[model samples]
Each structure stands twice: as structure tokens, then as C-alpha cells.
Target: MLNFLKKNAALIWAKKHVQKAEEFKKNAEKNQDELLLSLVDTAKKTLFGRTYDFENIQSVKDFQGKVPVADYEDLKPYVEKVKRGQRDILWIETPEYFAKTSGTTSGSKYIPISKEGMPFQVKGAQSALFHYIAKKNNADFVGGKMIFLQGSPELEEVFGVKTGRLSGIVAHHIPNYLQKNRLPSWETNMIEDWETKVDKIVEETERENMTLISGIPPWLIMYFEKLIEKNGKKIKQIFPNLQLIVTGGVNYEPYRDKMEELLGGKVDIVQTFPASEGFFAFQDDYTKEGLLLLTNHGIFYEFIPLEQYGKPDAQRLTLKDVELNKDYALILTTNSGLWAYSIGDVVRFIDKNPHRILVSGRTKHFTSAFGEHVIAFEVEEAIKSTVEKFPAQITEFHLAPEVNPEEGLPYHEWFIEFEKEPENLDLFKNELDDQLRKRNTYYDDLISGNILQKLHITRLQKNAFQEYAKAQGKLGGQNKIPRLANDRKIADLLKVYKK
Candidate 1:
């Protein structure tokens, strides 16, 4: 009776919001312009506003001229002031929370979430769920137990405001309606050790009616493997009602095959493009290949061409100017007071009518050792295409440049962990090389010019990535293996895991 009531209420909400979303999609361009002006108008009295002359910034070009494109380093001075309890340094008021982020390579950087801006993060998530419900014409998943595999919600006071991982901080804001259905128990989730937390999560959820499970792919893989091992049953058998999987932070294609294998069948996947900076985009249309870019959200975006990034003559374009399939460095001026901030992410538009995009790669996280800059999208797509022909079950993989080899020319090295490797490894490698070459012309030229050898693959033992993550103290919770690096830092560390 309770579940039935929940589903009906959710469906009603979905219908209303779905219509609003369509309206937003139709006026995306106008909405972006209005949002930009509104953000500037709101901050016109703040410290940054006075410095950038936000009052005189009447147009996009005016604003762009007033404020240069900024990265974290550029804003660090302002961020430091905010940390010292200085008000209106960036935003008008004090931040509601400081989302502490720790990447695999970088140290903790605190990203401010203002009271006005914070709701958009929560709303983006709620809107995604509502859209899914409306599209499917069902909210059955809400009726069953749902679990979000995330960080500990316990937060510390940073100066005066709340501080923790983005996921951890978001946990505090879970809607009252979801509190009843959400699982793993507050106690289990608070466990700091990821392995222990996963074990506890399995114990708490394996026997429940889990219909929707949400997490990054790598962590979910860990949870699924443990559950299967414990019961000697597929995930579907354990959670018969399980129907939906929500994923973000990383690409979903590489893990799709492995996840389906673990589940013993297919489940609906709703890929989201979210981060501490902002909840940017989410999968609204199941039929589409890319996520629907949120136009009405408190973010005004600047798409800088990937080639022209960081250059003085680089073009900065608004939504109307972006072309489909071309890579762009995603920059944001948002409600959080980020002004032309390059969040280091790269995206490509797949559709223009509603502006659906695919997260292509990161600006700083690609291989450019020999001027052959191989991106995450290219490598993942190449592997995806190669695996279609070769039949390989990839657990995880990473690529790094091999600058100094024992003998012969330098080459790109692939460290792959496989559940089921191809029958003919040599043929599989050749096909993979060909796929990569087709996608990346610089690599092909290097190979043709004999400047680099064919890419080499070092087969890694099972649980290699897991072991590597555990070694780094980042086994779970949003930390993903870097796709490619210019340096061999990760490659050298992964050498021991090679079979």
C-alpha cells in the first residue's frame, strides 16, 4: 500500500516536470542568455563583481572581455579569501557547504556550494529521476529498496560551513521520501574503509528487494562481484526486482558488458554527468545516445574548441555556436559564482535540437608524449569497437606512453585486466591497434613514419585495477583509473600486476 502510494505520487510529479523540461529544451538559447545576465546581475554587488565590473557587463562579449577564462589556479586567490570567512568574495553569502574533493593525483580542493546554488545540485538529480519516471510511465523502482553506494555522510566543520566529499555532502540532502526506501543503513555507509563498507553494504542489501542501485562503475563492480561470490547467484536472482542502475563520474560503455555479465541480464542504465562543480547533465531520453544538457539549471556554459584551448586566439562559443561531434573544453559561469571557469572536462554534442552531449575526456588527462594526444573517448571507443570483433571481457584498462623501452621504438602501452581475453591475443591486439589508428590520425602517422611501434598490451591478472586502487587508498567512491597519461607513473606502478 505504501509503495503503491509512493509510485502514484512520483508519477504525478514526473508528468508535470517532464513538460517543464520540454519547454526548457525549446528555449535553451534564450534561457542561457537570461541565466548569464541574471548571474551577473545577482553578483553585481559582490567583491568579484566590483573587480570584474559586473555592472557594466551587459552582454556575453562584454562579460567575456571583463573576465578572462579561469581555472582552479586562477580562482585560488578568491577561494583562499572565502576560506578565511570573507563574505561576497565570490558569491554574495557564505557557502552552505565546502565540497572537499580528492582526485587520484591531486590534493583536496574545497569547492563552495552556496545555499542558493546547492538546491540546483539536488534539483538536477530529482529532475533526472522525474524525467525517467515520465519517460517510462512508471515509478516502480521507487517502490522497491534503493541503495546509493557513496561516501560517508558525516561532515566536519570547515571554518564554519559543512565540509566533506560531494557524495557525502549530498547524502545529507536526500529527500525525505527517499529516506524510507534508501539502504545500506546510515551506520554501514559511515564506515570509512571502502572494502569494509562494500562488505557491509552486501550484507545489508543482498537479501533486500533492491530495484535501483546507484554508484560509479568501478565501485558497483566491486559490490556486484562480492555479492555474487557470497550467494553463488547472479545479481538479478538475489534482487529479483532490480531494474535500474544510475551511473556517473566515468563512462558506462567499458563496464556495460562486465556489469550485464555479472547481473546475468540487461538492466536500464541512466548515465549522468555530475561533479562537485555542478550537476551539469543527465540521461533524460533512454532512446538517445547522449545526456540531455541542462539549460535551465543555474549554469551558463562556454564551449572552447579542444585544439584552441589555452591559446590566446581560442574561440569561446555559446550554445548556439557549438557543432555536433566536435570536442570542446567545457567552461562554466554558474550560480556558485564560478566565472568562465574551465572545469577541466571535455564534451561533444551528439544532437543539436535539444543539445545532448557525451563527456569525451578531460583536458589534462590525455596522452601527448609524442604529440599523439590520445583521449579517453578515443581509447574507450577503440576498445569498444575492437572488443565487438575480438570478444574480450574487459574488467578495466589504462594506457600510458612507453618512452624508454628495452629495445626498438617507443610506443603506447595498454595495461588491461580481462575476465575473458580474446582466443588469439595477437589478432586482438592488431585489431585494437587498427581501431585506435583509425580514430587518432597522429598515432597512425607516427606508426607509418616508424617513429612509434604498434601499441603494446600487457595483460594484467584479475583484480589488478582493484588491487591498484586499494594500494592507492582510493578503491572506491568516485576515484577512477586514469584512461591515459603522458607519463609512465601509473604504468610503472601497474608493472607488478602484469601476468
Candidate 2:
């Protein structure tokens, strides 16, 4: 009955509003004010109203110069207030549940998750079906079992309570059939859960023919590596009917070559963009260039200039005035009752018609080590291109800056697990240097001077990263080994070899 209601409601809503969006797009310029008024008025009732200062929100939207930029740190007080079940700065009622953790950026940012909020995740996640129906033109997903590598189901109490993050909540709320059968029945539930426990996963996969796989990119890569190691050209021997692989949480390009090599071909892959704050968007079409924004349901969208976050003179943009192709930091006003909350992600509109967007990078994750701003994608590209120059294959790799207080230069130390050691380590390093120089000019400038940006390559014994992750309590059953660490201390935590 619940599923029926969900399907019918989504179908009815989509039919009405999708057409409304199309009609609005047809004469958006003419009906700009009217459309804006209608959207905000509806949003006021649906999202804002009693929780927030609706008049102030309208005033800010109307003023249009800039709004205050607030990170998780800034919102901590209010979020804590919500966690304690108090009337927060926004929400009139206490949130039903609180989202546990943020991603790799900050440790854990607890956010309010209402019953209203969970539906967005459900609807957004279900859009995968819509993607198949609309784009791939396939209706049924009655394939083999799906492996969703995420965080653990059991919540670790910080003080004395059980408040696991979104993953736990998601696990709790999954459809009964899905919950009963689809997941890997190990100790760890998600990628974070599986990180520490690969042997059990390998054993599980050996038994079952996994057709659909889902996880963060790094964990998926790690899982595939384990599969290859155990089976040895036996993936086809075991999972002959393996069809689709869905992944998110990290960038895909860096591991593309490695993943392809492991899979023996391109695994039919789907990338996802999900956050605890909101089910912001998902890849809708086959081209997979950008994700389609979930325009309605529970959230109100707003964009503020990336350059102006926290600055005095920053301008905020509404649905009515977002420009195309420009990078803007995201601020979400949601039914969970977060008003103008900065999710700390940066996205750019790739298309204006259906509001397609590309997630450029996180504002916090970018590295300016030695003043060379290298994003996750940029570093991934550099690593991929660097390895392509070598005849020997790279199994796993991690990058980080070797910061020395006594020394002047900041250099990148690469911890690489290889199938076969390269003949000339110097030559291999030179090739990587050349690739970085060609691909990232900022890196080149930093290295070309008196400061020698040395690439230290540590050849790992077979299954070294896997071993290391296991040793650090980060392997097999849901924990992930860091692919790129910004500093030496963090790198030391994950590195298999020191010198």
C-alpha cells in the first residue's frame, strides 16, 4: 500500500509539475515574476512558513545582493539544538531522526532528518528506476543481487546513544524485500562497514553471482581488486550475468582504467551525487554528463556565488535567476527545516532547460598544497595519465604532501601498489612529473623553481594496500582507504610504506 501510494503520488506529481516546468520554460522570461512568486509562495507553505522567517526569506530573495555563508561549523549550534530535540532556529517540531555524519571532508556533521526528508532520499534514489525507464528504456531491475557498499548499519555511540548516520537510517528504512535479500550479509553493511573485512566479502561473492553492485568509488575499486585476486580471471567464471554497477561518494575517472582492467571490460556504471543534507540530484540520461536536479518534493534550491561565501558582499540567487555555466556554492532550504544552509558543495549548471548540473568539487576537498589548487578530479586525472605511461600496471595508489617544518619544499609522496615493479623508478617518476606539468600548470610552476617537487614512489608488495587498510581497522567490512591525503600525518595513517 505504501509503495503503491509512493508510485502513484510520484507519477501524478511528475505528470503535473514536469509539464508545469516545461510550460514555465517556454515563457520563463515573460512570466519570471509570476513564476517566482508562485514557487516561493508554494515553497513558503511546503518548506518554510512557521519554521523560518518567511518574510525575511522573501526579503533576501528579493534583495538579491548576497546572503551569509554558513558551513557545518556555523550551523553546529543549531544542529545540536535540533539533536537535543529543542525548537531550533528554524524547525517548529523536533526532527524525527538526525543524519549521523558528513562525508570525508569533515568528521561528522549531524543534521536534522524529518519523516518529510527521508522521502526525498527515497524518491531521489528511486530515480535510478526512472533513469533506466527513461534513458536505458528498461523497466525491470529483476537482475541478480545488488551490493550496496556504504556505512555500517550499527550505530557507534559517541557518548552513550545510538545515532548512526544517514546510512543506518537508510538501512532501517529500505523496502522489506530489498532489506531481506539485496545486501551483502556480512558484519559491515556499507562500504565503510566492508572496508575492514574483505575476506568475508570475497567469500560471499564467491558464493553468489552479483549482477548489480553499488558503493562509493574507492570501496568498489577495492572490492573489485579483491575479486580479481581471489578468482584470477574467474569473475566471468563466477558472475557471468553481472550487468550493472552503480557508484558514488568519490570521483570515477582516476580509477576508470584500473576498474576496467579489473572488470575485464567497462562495467555498466551509474554515478550518484547524494548528501545527508538533501537528495540533491542524480544522473538522469545516458550521456551521464550532468545530473538532473530534483526540483520539487521537499527542498527549496538556492545558489550563492562561490567567490562570495562568508564575504560581506556576496549575492544569493534563487531558482528564478541562476545563470548557466557559472560555478556557484549550494545553499539548501529544506523541509527538514534547514534554512539557507550551506552544504559546502560547489556545482555549475550545465543546462538551464531541465536544470542539469555538474558537481565540480567540494569547497573543502580541493588542495592548494604549495599553492597549486588540485581538485580530486584533477589529481585523479594526473594519476590515471601518469600510470598510462608505464608498462607495469598500477593496482592501487595514494597521493599526499610531505610537509616538513625544517625543510622549505612541499613534495608529493605517492604510495603505489603495483602488479610488477617498474624497471626505472627515476624514469617513472619523471613521466609522472611530466604528466603533472602538462595537466596542472600550477603544480608545474611550484615544482619548476628552486623548490624540487619530488615524486617519491614506494613499490608495495602484493595486496599491500588491502593489508594496510586491514591493519588500520579500515579494511574489508565498510571502511575505505584514503586515495589522496592532503598532508603527511593523514598519509601516515594509510600508507603501506614509509620510506
Candidate 3:
């Protein structure tokens, strides 16, 4: 009976999702203006629409002129009103659910999630799986159990609106039949305490026929470690059928070596770009070029060049106008309440035909103290290159700028927590510095002029970042270590655990 359900469901879902992808491609090619106009027409009755004069908007240019690009801070006051039972403020109706996200700049944030936008979140994951299975030509992927390592499904009410982590809300909406084939049952997932939940997951999935696993990289590593310890075998030894691993929320390049090492073999990996605002993009192709932007998923997108990100009057480009291979700050007007919202993520387009993008980094996550602007994507690539050059495996890392009156010159400090320590620490540091120099011209110029000293490396104790996150009460479930900080706040915090 289970086999019958799995096979039939996979067939139905794959066919439906392929059609959706094709429609997305067609829309990307031509119907972007139509989609934008339709969204405005649908939202004109809402309070935000009225305030922004969505009724009079005739073209993309008109919409852009009327609505100001905004961050979460700008939307918070209206969200607060929605939380207090206000109706039709941003969307057609008051949101029945809110996704609570750990705001790095602000305090915690409650993003409105309407009924209309819920399917897009589920559809994003489904489309990703559909593309992967179709690419691998393996419909049997549905025959075995899959594990989604996510937050608890249990929810709380905020002024009559259901509220919880975004993943938790998605989990709660999973179809009953699919839930049967998912591991670490609802009870275990609701355990709140991450350490305890991990132990329970190990015990429950130890002997199950697990085929797929999905989560952020760090927590997934912890689970794999626990599995190895408990069963006295690598992941493949226990779950030989395991074929695919899905991850996001951080760069997977740094964790690839350790992950493959623990799994005991090469495995297919899929990267996704999902956030509290909306499900934006996913790895649709096998190649490592970039993620396919979902152009028609009840979300409209705008891009601002990174250079003009915070300017008083920055130019916003629609899909038709955006060029290939330029870093842009992503803005979204979703089916949910968020309008002209700057999602804070930076992306660079790699392909124009299908509109594929590589998530470069965050808008606030860059260093320019010495007039040498370095973004997080460059830092991540440098780390990956340096690790490959050496034999080190980095578990977690943070970068910060160091400037002291006593010291002769300022330099960037890297605090790295290594799973497998490098043989020659000095050589590793030099290689990393060289990789950064090759990647960023501005940084290289600074080094050549001797305006900036050589980069410094500080090896951190194992689990230093985990401990720090725990101390800050953000240990798990979408809370991540910021890869780059403008100042020494994160550096000073992690210095106590330096080796």
C-alpha cells in the first residue's frame, strides 16, 4: 500500500511540477509585466495598496515610482498593527499565521503569511525534488523515508494569529500521507531542545530505511556525527539507499569535505534559498552554476545594484532590465503582506536564459573600513579554496576587521573552528590570505600598497561558535553565525575560545 502511494504520488507531483516549471520559464520570458500588473490589481483593495496608489499604477516604472523599497524595519509598524487584529492592511485579509524569524539587526520579527502564499513554500520544495528526481531518473526516491531536520510543528498564538518558526509552519502543513514517510515523528520534532531532539532522532532513524535528508549544514553535521557514534558506522553503511542531501541557510562549500567524509561517499547535494518572506529560488540543475529563480510563484522581484543599495534614490530593475553577473540587492513583493521588501540577500545572476542566480551574500555583511570592500561570497570562496589547498576542514568561521592604536596597521582577523585541524597552521593562513588577494582586487591593492597588514588567523576551539550561539539563545533552527562583521564585536566574543 505504501509503495503504491509513493509511486503514484511521485508520478503525479513530477508531472504537475514540470508543467509549473515550464510555465515559470514562459512567464520569465514575457509575462513579467502582466504578472506585476495582476498582483497590483489583486492588492489594490488592501490598505498598503491604497496608500501606495496601486490602483493608478499602469507600468513597472509606475509601480516602482509609487512604492518605496523598504526593509523589515519599515514594515514593522504595519506588521504590529496586523498583529493587533487589523484586517486588510497589507493583503486582502488578515494573516492567519506569522513566521517568526530571528532578526539580526532588529529584535525578533513576525512576518505575515497568508493562505495564498502558503502553497508557494510547499511548491518550492516539491519543485526542487521533482527536478532532482527527474534529472536522476529515479522515481524510487519516494519509495523510502525522508527526513526534514526542522523546527517543531507546535505553534503559539500572537493576538489570534498562529506564530512559529517558518519551517515549523511548513511542517504543520505537510500532507498527512507524506507525514507517514517522514522520520523523527511529530513528537520528536517538537522537543524544542536541539541536543535532546538530535538524540531522539538518532534512536528513531537508526534502523529506518532513510533515503533523503534535508537541513542546514551545521546541524546536519551534528546529526551525522551522532549517527556515526551511536551505530558505529558511517552514514552510507547505515542507510545505503540514501541518495540526496538538501541544504541551505549557509554556504555548503566549506562543509562539503567533512560531509562527504562522514557519509563515506560522494552524494548528490541540492541547495535552496527559502526565507521567512517567501521561497525565492532553488537548485534546479545538476551543475553548480546557480539557482533557478522561480519567476511566477506568486512573487514579483526587483533588483538594485549593490553599489546603489542604500542610496536615497536607487534605480530598481525588473527581470527584463537586469544584466548578467552583477551583484544586486533582492527585493520582493510577495503574495503575502510584504510589499517592495528588501529581503537583505545579495545575488549575482549567472544565466540569463532561465534566470539563474548565485546568492552572493547579505547587504549588511561586508567590510569597507580600509576602502577595500569585501563581500561574504568572496570570503566563502576564499575559505573553500584555502581548505582545498590544504587538508583542513572548517566547521564554523567568522571574519572581522581589527584596528588597534598600538598595533602598526589594521588587518582582517579570521576566527575559524576546525573539525580537522590543518597540519601547518601558518601555511594555511598564508594560503587563505593569497586566495582572498586573488579574489578581491581592492583587497589586493591594499596589500600591495602596504596600507593594510597581512590577514591574521586565530584557530578557535571546537564548538566555539555553537557554544556562543547557545549563550546568545540562538543555538538552532535558522539562526546562523554571521560570516562577516564590520567591527570586532564577534571577534572579541569568540577570542576567549581561541586556541
Cα lDDT, all candidates: 0.90, 0.63, 0.87
Better of 2 and 3 by TM-score: 3
Model 1 local distance difference test score: 0.90
Poorly placed runs, candidate 2 (over 4 Å):
1-53, 59-67, 102-108, 139-141, 154-162, 176-181, 186-198, 302-310, 315-328, 348-350, 392-396, 403-410, 419-428, 448-486, 494-496
- Candidate 2's displacement at residue 254, Å, is 1.3
Q: Best by TM-score, which number?
A: 1
Order candidates by TM-score, high to low: 1, 3, 2
**TM-score comparison, 1 vs 2, better candidate:** 1
Please give me the total number of clashing residue pairs in predicted model 2: 27
Order the candidate numbers by lDDT, best to worst. 1, 3, 2
- lDDT of candidate 3 over 1-499, digit per residue (tens): 8787777778777767776677667569467778778889888988899999998999888999899999999998889889999888888888868999878678889999999898888888888888887776666657888998779888999889999999999997776767888988889999998888889999999899988899999889889999998888999999998888988887787788889989997578999999888888899875565899988778889999998999988889888888987899999988887888999899999988789999999998888888777999899999999998887888889998887736778899999999988899889988999999998999999989988888888888988988988887778778788898888888898988998
**Evaluation by lDDT, superior candidate among 1 and 3:** 1
Candidate 1, residue 74: lDDT: 80
How large an RMSD does model 3 have?
A: 1.6
Checking candidate 3 for backbone clashes, the offending pairs are none
